[model samples]
Target: MRVTRSLTIKQMAMVSTVTLIIVSLFILLQLFHFVQQRRLDYAQQMESVALTIRQPLSEAVLKADIPLVERLLATLKLSGVIARADIVLPDNIHALHNEFILEKPVPALVSHLFELPVSIRIPLYSPERAMRGPLALLVLQADSARIYQFIRVTVATMLIAYLLLALMLTVAISWCINRLVIRPVRHLALALKTLAPEDLIAHQLPLLVGHRDDELGQLIMAYNHNQQTLGSIYNEMYCKASGFALPSLPNEALFLALIEQHSKSVENAAPLAVIVLRVETLQETHTLVTDDQRNILLITLVNRIRDCIDASCVLAQINHSDFALLITRDSHIFRTMRLARKMTRKLTQPVTLGQFQLHPETSMGISLHEKETPHAKELLNRASSAMMSAHYHGKNQINVFRTGNGDG
Candidate 1:
């Protein structure tokens, strides 16, 4: 199986982000529950301590015993559960130990603002019915430092776990997705790169994926069928021709096919110009030369035409005496005219053929197709007519055929 390496990092990042969010929410919920539970437990412990010392605290306040009251308060503070303790008498007298007094009021205020202290006020009463009224009030404040520290530790532990879990999940999820989805797609793409009509017919292409009745399997089967059909059509068109040889340029069949294809497509609606170059003295030269010499002359003329025009222009040998050039409207009228004049001058120059030198007279006829035409045959006919008109005008002449023109 092909291993897909791309998109792994991106997929991992996406999965990690989602996992982190979920884990963070879960940890936050647990932290909130823990804080509330701690606060409730602290409140219960303070309430139980207040209840146990209620009678003693009430008697110390009734007797006006300062030392005894101080000792009772000291015991509550020493328990470590209470940060501060205060005694309030019925006469509106409030007393507290100096040891519990905050040295820096700012830190105490800040602590109170961040972590609320558990404050419990217990009312004391006498044993007699007539003394049912409260003797004193026991006020207890629980130290919140331990609770806040626990919360900090829990938060740090949760964050560490979150990081570890995210990393593990990213790796595991990326591996699974790469193996199941990305690997198959990559393999299919690699196989498609090697798929060609020729290779299909020869059975030379390799199957990168295993056979299955999935979408990918169906796609591969369809592609193979299409390749076979195209290969058969190509063989029928070019292979069945007489002598089974490739069509040479100026082959009317190939030229017509190109024109027909262009006509069917709107994007290729730009004007197409066909230029016919006729050698007036070719018939005379044919009788004076052998077949090899004729071939040499044709080759020389073809080369000269090629030198005059850009590579984009198509050059074709129409017959023994005529050659055809197909150019686009973008080639400009002036450029085409200059090229035609240049071809006439070059072909007329003296060329050494065996022991004799011959000067051939050539004429060019151009016909532009500005509007849609039924077929390429019509364009060829018009170009040929223009050439005949140039012949009438005399040797080395160039004529452009226009609609309603005498030549057209």
Candidate 2:
């Protein structure tokens, strides 16, 4: 329920990691596709080179002209990639060529008369029947570095484009998350921190900005629900714990009010009872639990006592170990004594704390309203004196203060 800075850090980290993983997977898939495309293009380029030289060699074979074939092959060899070329004719006739007109037989597919742009093993098989007029065989060995350079350039371009796109997407996604999710949560956190423990009226909750069906919307709804629940609890606790002075059991503010009303009430003075209740051995309980746990136990005790009292009975926290109750009715003495006995009895039962159970004790003191009491200060001193006497006597006891007349 208490939103902390650590929660914000953890949420941001989770969202960022998810974004990174998604972007990485997309980039990897695109790179794989790009590599495959480049490889296929290279294969097609190599096939095109092999096909281009086919027509010229076939024409040379049709004419049965060796000199013309030799000149054509030599011209093609100027492409710096051709290694060998051959025109096989019907009846065992052959027109073979090379780059330098080598004296030895040419190797299997490395001809000296064909042109290619990159390193490739291309086997050119004549599409005609074996006994046909002409059959051309072309082989080429080109520079590999040139092909690799082209592929590198193309891949580099694609990668650059992909990187730009990825960066744009990352920015857009982070911005959206910051606006729709992170910003709202931050505002809610700020609102939570500034809230006073006494504030009762609920302020309007902020509305979610983006997709209603999404997780961020759900988070906003959950946060609002939790805030409302805590707000209600705080209001109830604040009102129950406000406006009384302990030991004397007077509202310091209301004492002025009583003074203003004293002239009218003096003609028929009503009895008043002030009860000062102390949780005994609270220091021992403090040693038994953490500060937070001690607060929980003490708050539990306060709520229990509050359930037994009415709204007119002003109650307030006096100290870490005590609470005060002031009743203004004519029957205040009887009601205060009865409620104190019931509350002290209830506290003697064991309370569960994790795996341990603790039994707490209470001591209470009662002081009656005196018509002759000079001020609020005197009333409080007498009540505190009675409470101290009860605590000094023993645990779980109630002592009442009396004037020298011993009437109260």
* Per-residue C-alpha lDDT of model 2 across residues 239-341, encoded as one tens digit per residue: 4454432232334445434533543464356666677778875657777788767767776777677777787666655667876666666535667788878
Model 2 earns a TM-score of 0.41
For each of the candidates, give the backbone clash count.
Answer: 0, 7
Regions of model 2 farther than 4 Å from truth: 1-72, 78-137, 199-221, 227-408
Error of 1 at 84 (Å): 1.0
- In terms of TM-score, the best-performing candidate is 1
